[model samples]
Target: MSDKKTLQEIEKEHRDSHFAEKSMQYWRSWGSWFSWGSPVGLGLFFIETAVAAWIVAQIVK
Candidate 1:
């Protein structure tokens, strides 16, 4: 319940914290997923779809 914290004090505390570094690290980790993971996931999805379509075609023939 310490409501006496000044804005400058809060800003100083934030500067001393590792919040920015940790947040950047989090986004860097997800950056790989965006760069490489999405294409791999899409490739798998297309493969599965092709397999399913082929099976359906075989059954219908």
Candidate 2:
């Protein structure tokens, strides 16, 4: 057998590397904005939920 990667294998590797890079970029740029662990993100989420609940309560009354 020859020591060579098939075309599909090469393409898969390239695609996987691209995906990993993009994922890292996303995490660095905007992931914290939506992450529950971040204080700002968590605060925003709680505020939104509270507003929604209040609206529902008003509608149900």
Candidate 3:
């Protein structure tokens, strides 16, 4: 508690220059392998799965 001015009161003078985050957003930032490259991973996973299934079928048959 300052006798002259509180810290909150002093900060209020400069607060007009700052803006709040007003927009609610669902945003994708450009980044790594988990982004657009995920389909390739999924495709590879499916291919590996298919190969394993084929091997299993060959063994069973």
Candidate 4:
């Protein structure tokens, strides 16, 4: 029998050959910053609020 690749197999081989994978996709690195930024910003806001309250209390004492 003659050896031959099917259309699907040939297409798969072509697709695999042209595969492009970026170690860092567009804005992928900034993804972590976005994910972590909300929590960090919230934490800072709470800290600032607490400090402001404490300062006001101390001043009123």
Candidate 5:
């Protein structure tokens, strides 16, 4: 018998790996902000949100 992954299996594995990487990145960023305390975390949160909103607005225009 030969060992081979089907196309669907390969796609699923790639998606799962991508999601895991994104999740790790999110948590690492969150932890970095959390370590800085509430004020700094809140500041960073607002800055990120504003940037996201601006991007969305630009896209909508």
Candidate 6:
């Protein structure tokens, strides 16, 4: 371990080296799931509930 490097210096160096790639990787991973898959998932859930409600209505009537 180099005793000359301060904590802030080490942190700054690590952040500079990894921040962009790490941030981009995280955003890219979530972006597709949130933008596309979430809506599809929600739509399926809604349709399923609607169908259940229709079945209940038919049974009651």
- In model 1, which runs have C-alpha deviations exceeding 4 angstroms? 1-37
Each model's C-alpha lDDT? 0.82, 0.93, 0.63, 0.73, 0.90, 0.84
Report the number of clashing residue pairs per model.
0, 0, 0, 0, 0, 0
Candidate 2: C-alpha RMSD to true structure equals 3.3
Clashes of 4: 0
Candidate 1 vs candidate 4: the lDDT winner is 1
lDDT of 4 by residue, 1-61 (tens): 8599899999998776665334355457656555536776567678889999999999999
Model 5, 1-61: lDDT tens digits are 7599999999999999999999999999878776647788778788999999999999999
Provide the TM-score for each candidate, comma-separated: 0.41, 0.55, 0.41, 0.41, 0.52, 0.41
Best by lDDT: 2
lDDT of 3 by residue, 1-61 (tens): 6489878887986674342322212223222333546776567778889999999999999
lDDT of 2 by residue, 1-61 (tens): 9889999999999999999999999888787777889888899899999999999999999
RMSD (Å) of each candidate, 1 decimal? 6.1, 3.3, 9.4, 9.2, 10.6, 6.6
Compose the digit string of candidate 6's lDDT tens values, residues 1-61: 7679898999999998798889899988877665535886577778889999999999999
Compare candidates 2 and 6 on lDDT and give the better one: 2
Candidate 2, poorest ten consecutive residues by summed lDDT: 26-35
Candidate 4 error regions (>4 Å): 1-37
lDDT of 5: 0.90
C-alpha-based local distance difference test score of model 4: 0.73
Better of 3 and 4 by lDDT: 4
The lDDT of model 6 is 0.84
